[model samples]
Target chain A: MVLSLTLLFVLSSGADGRVMHIKSLFASPLSEPRVGAQRTINLSRGTKVSVVTTQDPWVRIRFAAGTGWVLNAVLSDSPPGKTSSLLDSGADVSLNARKRVSGFTSAAAARGLREGADDFSGSKFRPDFESVRNMEGGYVNPDDGYAYILNGRTR
Target chain B: MKQHVAAAFFVLTALLPVAGAQSGAPALSRARAHQGVISTEEDHGDLTAEIRFGRALAARILGQYKLSADDKTGGYVSRVGAGLVAMSGRPEIRFHFGVIESNEINAYACPGGYVFITKGALSLMSGEAQLAGVISHEIAHINRKHVVRALKIHGGGGSFASGIAAMIGGTSDSSRVILGSLMDRGMDLLFKDGLSIADEFDSDADAQENMVAAGYSPAEYRRYLQKISDAGPGKTTSILSKTHPPLAGRIERLKQREGRLGENARN
Candidate 1:
């Protein structure tokens, strides 16, 4: 147990110093805070650079031979050991699916508990077998199909 | 009556060349002969005469445009434009440069030393050499007398369509009718006409010659052209396309003439 716990702590610390990759070029014609003409930089197709600092929409990065600031919108977290193409394509899909499933389960449990309870006494007690089964099997919810369809993860 | 007097004065100026040959006015005779050809008829002339008239006319038209003659901006423009002009064989003609207030990206020259460039044109230029490229082209127009000769050929009517109408002598009313038809066509000619392509090529050639003469790299013209081209088509057709040469063809011509122009840094 101690060995396992130590390994987990090391792993958690390792994840803290993650490096962010710059995905876009942002330049303003003037050095002013606003009213400057902004343009995108597209140096290469798969170029990678790390962020040194960020302030809202602007981020400064160190690129080959120099450092410059780019827009924050042009960047995304670089996934571990994966090429940018795969990370970009799969990251949003998996994250959205997981969030939808967890949200649905919690919502259904709360609705079932509320509807089955008659008073404070009943509410404090465990739900009946039918109520528990109905909630778990998706019978307590008439909108499960609709939710799945809307979430886009049903297929 | 005033117009008649002006015409008589012009004629006397033309005849003075022949009448003064036996007198001690040989230099005046030569000056009159040069002026006669420029005044009596309009055609591109030898280098020295074109340079003289280009400097003179540029000054007059630039004054008419009400451009500021303040030494600050005017001095900067003349310094840059003259450096480029000096490369075109160091002609004796003075160079006059002016900045216009309009937001349009345009630069053009009138006869005799006038070059007017808009602030909008300056905003678009990325560097000093790009400005040189544009000014050199306008100087070529003065040297070629493209506008004045076209005006004389077309009877002082505004544009190409009017020139065509005047050539046929359809009617005084016909000139008005031609002017009406030109409202839309004129925009096309002014904005996308092919003559500009030829002018652009000539200017590019002249600019290359001037750049080499000034001891700057001629390749900068190519680089500057690429930047303007990359800025994408302007809001209207590029003044370059409308009043100058096709970019791709001019670039290719510059490339061909690259070796003959004096050597300088490539970048």
Candidate 2:
């Protein structure tokens, strides 16, 4: 009963709207209020958790695994796919804007980035103008990257 | 008596989210559920603004550097980078990793998960670890929102998501006029490498953390720094060196962090 009341008291302390996830495996969680306490559970990177409360470095969170205390360092409010500007940027700024903004280059327009940067800088051409034209994109599978790094080679 | 009353009221408030969750609604916080009279949603949308602006800069940067002729290089860097970003706090943001075909040994990140490394930097990289170091460093910047925070760009105030979204992709004159002012400041940051010293240090430190988390050695980053520093009179060092603190200072800071991280890992 006392434990439940303590939980209640802590929960009401404010830290709402934040739903962060584990950003680093180095995030060691403490069972007690103080940090570096006897490590009870080790959270893997990318584990999602809802922050119930925060106290400096420690945050009390609720997860499917159960409620626990973790460091604020491990948490990030960045929910996946939230940055999809095609969707997330709500319907407010379209009042007087044009339908097509050519400045918004496609991801495939690698050289477009160069040109935009050059134009912004008052037309000082980049050293490798030819190379920029040669830039291209293809079907990139992220899994290939995972295999390379896990194999212990970066390039 | 007042303490009990307040406690009871808070307890009722706290359970509101739990009840809402049960009814199949997104968990509502006390701040959202009970605004009394004022809405705090304005400050909330700032994160959205920061991301949209970062993407705008990311596109501008791509337009400046152009993608490399080697399509395979982007795939390679993307893989290494994705691994580290998976370990970042904001893995939720889709990261578009590309390689720039420049001879300068440099790597930069625009907001909203757009990271780029010049061909020069990639050519000098001996192995995946060094690549991870550079990519992770840039990822660290995006994760920390260093550039956006430096510019003091806030969300809303009539420049809501539509405005930001339109500004990023729309070609309208109004969008350019309004967003031009904001993007112009951001562009200056991009060309001059004008991130504050503190943000650079923070990115370096955080990059190390991301590297280690992804199972690469942070020492490799220090080694990369040493390599460039020793080269001294190279094209790679020209612009990147100016925007950042001295190489010696950065290495020292990393060395200290290495010790702390080691201790933290052990305990």
Candidates' DockQ values?
Answer: 0.00, 0.14
Candidate 1 per-residue lDDT over residues A83-139, each given as its tens digit:
111012122222342453344445534433222221111111121322221111211
Whole-model Cα lDDT per candidate?
Answer: 0.41, 0.55
lDDT of 2 by residue, A1-155 (tens): 99988778766643453677665533445565442346556676556777777653356777665666664445655423332332222223222212112222333143222223321122122233223222212212234445557775433
lDDT of 1 by residue, B1-267 (tens): 323221221111221222122122212111011111212222222322233223333333333344543546554565666555433311223345677555666776654445677777777776666776777777665554444333221222123222222222122443333332322222222233423344456556666544443334567778767766676777633555556655677777787666433123243
Error of 2 at B102 (Å): 1.5
Q: Candidate 1: which stretches are off by over 4 Å?
A: A1-155, B1-71, B89-92, B153-196, B236-238, B262-267
The 10-residue segment with the lowest total lDDT in model 1 chain B = B27-36
- Please state every model's RMSD to the true fold in angstroms: 34.3, 14.0
Say which candidate scores most in lDDT: 2
Scored by TM-score, the top model is 2
What count of clashes does model 2 give?
19
Q: Is the docking of candidate 1 incorrect, acceptable, medium or high quality?
A: incorrect
